[model samples]
Target: MALISPFLPPGTINNVPQPVLTAKTLSLRPWTAGDTPVVFAAHKDPAIALWHRRRIEGLEESQAVIAQWAGQWEKESGASWAVCDGKGLVVGRAALSRINLFEGDGEVGYWTLPTARGRGIASQAVTALREWAFDAVGLKRLQLTHSTRNKASCRIAAKTGFAFEGIKRSALRHEDGWHDMHLHAAVSATPSG
Candidate 1:
């Protein structure tokens, strides 16, 4: 029998897996107090602010953000992993957000520290999250969206096997202005490989 069906329950997100998903170069795991410095540094990068449209103002806020990241799993609204390198230093982040359990859908997003770019870190982190979302968490559909201008993000989504869906005109409001977004998605019914 198939694992996924259209008749999933509304609180299916209660099953969000908290396992540490390991990739070839990354260990996607829960956030901790020690990750505060890395989180602060990543958000301080202007490019991250430009793309994500949110920035951590100070150490306190960074702590709060880590706390919030931890709380997301319990709330069943989202789950985020600290993308750490072999040394256990957080080089990036990956998250499944906007989770709708009744609909079995979630949105995936990620950001890498400036030092980690061009190393394929973001794509690997995303791939790990995608696998857990489908195979472990039982999420049926995962969507990824990025600004049309974000070429790197687009590439990461494609590299992770998220098929291009379409463009959402003025889909998001960033500090600069309203911007169009490119939508991509993956469904659990299909084999990623």
Candidate 2:
């Protein structure tokens, strides 16, 4: 039996610099150490803390997280971007995690700062990341999962053209308990428009 070839080559993502993607009102750029304060503050929001289930704790931890995000790019394991508004204020984060080059797939995750909520920042950031993942990085599919109780994330997934797949029963655990998650997905062949 012949072994299957990888859908994307190993250097597909790591060969070039992680790009800065721009939407009409938002820009998604690689996270930097200087953004540590923004990241630390964003995690202080109760909603973000509840949904993401991790805290920055302090400036030091935030800087470490940023370093980890950058290292992931070099390792070809993941990519993370800091979402900024038109005026260059860091407002959120968007990322592709669990990237599998052989499978041409990755998982999408994002969160917006409290002030940026209800402004579609997450949707725009996710849309930009989706395009980069599919077109530039050569990923064939992307999956996004959110806690069932996170109606906002569900809306973002739908608005960004990630079709509703189904629920993953008790898929993740948070401070409260295990939560059912809604899984949404998008494929490269399908236009997000």
- Every candidate's CA RMSD: 3.9, 2.5
Clashes of each: 0, 0
Per-residue lDDT of candidate 1, residues 26-87 (tens digit): 89999989888888888889999999999999989999999998787878889999999999
- Residue-wise lDDT of candidate 2 within 66-170, one digit each (tens)? 999999999899999999998998989999999999888999999988887998888889999999898877788999999999999899999999999999999
Candidate 1 lDDT (Cα, whole model)?
Answer: 0.88
For this target, which candidate reaches the highest TM-score against the unseen true structure? 2
lDDT of 2 at 40: 93
TM-score of each: 0.91, 0.96
